[model samples]
Target: MSSVRKIVSTLVFAALTITSFQPALALSRVKDLVEVEGIRENMLVGYGLVTGLNGTGDSLKNAPFTQQTIQTMLERMGVNTRGQTMQTKNTAAVMVTAKLPAFASTGNNIDVSVSAMGDAKSLQGGTLLVTTLFGADGQIYALAQGPVAIGGFSAQGDAGSVTRGVPTAGRIPNGAIVEREIGFNLAAERSLKLSLRNPDLTTAARIASAVNTYVGSPVAVASDPATVRLAIPADYKGGVVGMLTDIEQVKVATDQSAKVVVNEATGVIVMGSDVRISTVAIAQGNLTIKVTETPEVSQPGPLSNGTTQTMPRTKIDIDEGKGKRMIVMKEGVSLQNLVDGLNALGVGPRDIISILQAIKAAGALQAEIQVIG
Candidate 1:
């Protein structure tokens, strides 16, 4: 009985020791925070016209295209203006644009944006005409037409013009109807590929292992750190969507590269999550200079027929501030500790950037440094 108890105790101690020194468990599930690939929104564009504006419409003299369109529209309403020239006020020409949401259905209404393309002063009080929206293939994907809802107002005078926001552009709520649907066939793929936002070998291998263990089969394999190839199985052959739905729900640990980001113009600094440094010492120095200019007049002694002359005088000065708090950063330190040590010296953000560069130059920092405006 005593020997059996001792054996059990030794096994328990060994298990605890191994667990303590093991690597950090990254997200063990499958999917990332964002969608991988072939899953996004589509853009649709169209041309249209706006009417019902107060005299602030397109000028027929400048935009003949507007006049021609109006004429054609009027003729369609049984008005004969083939050779007759009829001008109408309170109308504007505009271009319409909208984003087709992912997996849009036919006959579904969506919002559209309308912008005046002519010399119209405002589209605040206007209604858009029906226009067909086309995709990249020039095929009609949707139809847009609705009342304009300009959020700004404009007033003009001989002295100046004052306007806020964009009076020439406005959005119409549910003014466009989807006439066509883009095909997104996930089931058609006998095998699916999972692409990672970042490429990391450790993460890819972990994902392949987790999927195989969870599903009890080797359905997922890592092609590279950034791409994972998944085979469609028999149970999930006709259920690709279902399988993906389950796969995306699984979480995987994310790994980032070792990098240091600095913004000089805005004085911003960001340390990468995985940055580490070796045993290196860092020292920062600053230099400042000042120059002053003054003028003086030199007169001839006792006015001995000599003209007074003006002389330019200058003074130069340099003041070096004494170093404060010579801080020491140890080797193999984490980013959090490193930044905390620097911040303890009350280093300004811009100065921090300079110090970091100096550290990189001295081979102390083992991470990439990026500067942005």
Candidate 2:
């Protein structure tokens, strides 16, 4: 009996240790928390046409842009159209869009998304012609041209129409080639600036400390909660690439403010670890009402010559659920305790959402509550 008790005690201690070992704060790599300034993707857009759509393309009379673009394309191909009126239903006008990543070089291929810009039935099995994709500065940066790979299809018959996925938008892998590159040199800067996606003073301080410790010198400075400045060290003066690589690999502990997010449309509720609530009591119940109607026909007695008659009867019932039972939550309750208490109440997700809103309104919830549809 003594040996058995000792073994059980040891197992219980080990289990407790394992369960309590979770880090209250999460560790995140520098690369995910911060981004190098001036290093981002640029949006490129253009208008073009998609051809080879089997009889599902836009009507020429309805989508004039399709006819006009075809005419212009044909004219560019050295076709004379002095008095020509052509009609074709195998083409669609589309908007070509691509993201030009930083440091993209000439002759490099990139993917492009093509969306129907006019009233088109489907863009499946279509080929996009050469189109000039221009940046926001109005400078031509790349050219997009390739066969569109549509992920959806549509079919129609005398009965009705059926569509699977979106057939009007498609993607062309490696369809655009970069012609010009953005002028920015990473190694030329004396100091590199890292911008945090979510600004927090404590996280910035931790990052700065981690960098300084790793480099054995004070090369990183937390200029603000959102920005960190790093001066290039003499040994790394050859190139800032190595320093950036090291800085991005450092891991720092992260903490966020307590917040409770609720989505009413899907009835989703998310609570952070630090979420708490003051002592509060909640009582909720539902009332249901139902009405039933019945119609009956009455026949005249035999040989009485009485006319037939119809009678209507209605029944109504009202039911109030089991009397509301109040549940009291103590102050600074743990998430497990709160969840168990709510579960014992047997309320649904939507009911929980409404209860949380009421609690927040009553100033009992000790965290910010965000409600989204």
Candidate 3:
């Protein structure tokens, strides 16, 4: 019995020790906080033609380019339509766009977006022709050809028409086949850089520290707030790829600057965790003046020859909010305290935005105020 009790107590003590050493929930993996440089997507764009439209295609007389493209395509198919008036409403000129993902191999299929470049009412049930997608370097990298899948439709009668969603734009999943590959040798590289999505000096340093601790050496260094440089050690195996795979999993606690973002158009306010404020007094009020007009009719008395007339009367009322009082905030208030203080004043988001701006102007706000939209 004594031995069994001692074992149980030992297990409980071990469990508590493990729980105490567990990482905090606020820590984030290095991969989510930073992006590996040179591993990115490339934009590819092309011009194509959509066929099989149901009388909702581009008008040939209005879009001359559409007629010209059609003529050129038919000439390649051993048909001459240049001298003839070919009025067709089953084709539309469209622009095709796709993104070539990082390390995309040849023959890999990618999705493509098709948008009507001309005045096409709808692209429903249209099939895209063979379009050569070009990269920014003007080199063809992919070929796109598939049936366009649109989310909306258009139907019109003699008087009215109703459309749902965007009928002129559609997508074709796995519509593009990559014909070329962007050459990148991740394993052969001697060094690599990590770019922080949100640049901060403290976050960068913390990331560097985490990487060094994981590798048991100072292999990573924070060069700047936005970039961290990592040098491959000589004894490190599996090359740069292996080193990155191991370091990216290391967790680090990130820090950010105190900021207050307010969107005037949406009346949204976002305050950071570290936001602080100095002692400031704030008072919010509004003044409104209202004018009302009333018309009075004047009539002749006892059937005299006087004409009836209208006399204008105006009433003006002025209201100055005199019930509002000034509220004093102490120095070094946290974000929650600040929100509570603002809410105590019974003001809406718009009014709070104005008050924050006024506080910032008076040099009382310690955090950076960003007004957007």
Clashes of each: 4, 0, 0
lDDT of each: 0.82, 0.89, 0.93
Question: For model 3, what is the error of residue 13's alpha carbon versus the real structure, in angstroms, after optimal superposition?
Answer: 14
* Cα RMSD for candidates in order: 6.6, 4.1, 5.3
lDDT tens string, model 1, 103-187? 8899898999999988998998899998988888889999998789989989999999998988988999999999899898766
- Candidate 2 C-alpha lDDT tens digits along 1-373: 9999999999999999998996665889999999999899999999999999898788888888788888888898998764677677789999999999999999999999999988888998999999999999999999999999999989999999999999999999999999999999888878888998999888888899999999899999999999898888767744688888877889999766778899999999998887899999988787889999998999999999899999998999987867657899999987777777888787888898898889899999888899888
- Per-model TM values vs. the true structure: 0.74, 0.86, 0.86
Off by over 4 Å in 2: 1-24, 290-319
Better of 1 and 3 by TM-score: 3
lDDT of 3 by residue, 1-373 (tens): 9999999999999999999999665889999999999999999999989999989899998888999999999899999987898789889999999999999999999999999999999999999999999999999999999999999888889999999999999999999999999999888777889999999999999999989988999889999999999999867987788888888899999998889999999999998988888999877776879999998999989869999999999999988877767788999998898888888777899999998888899998998999899
Model 1 TM: 0.74
Report how far off residue 27 is in candidate 3 (Å). Answer: 0.9
**10 residues in a row with least lDDT, candidate 3:** 319-328
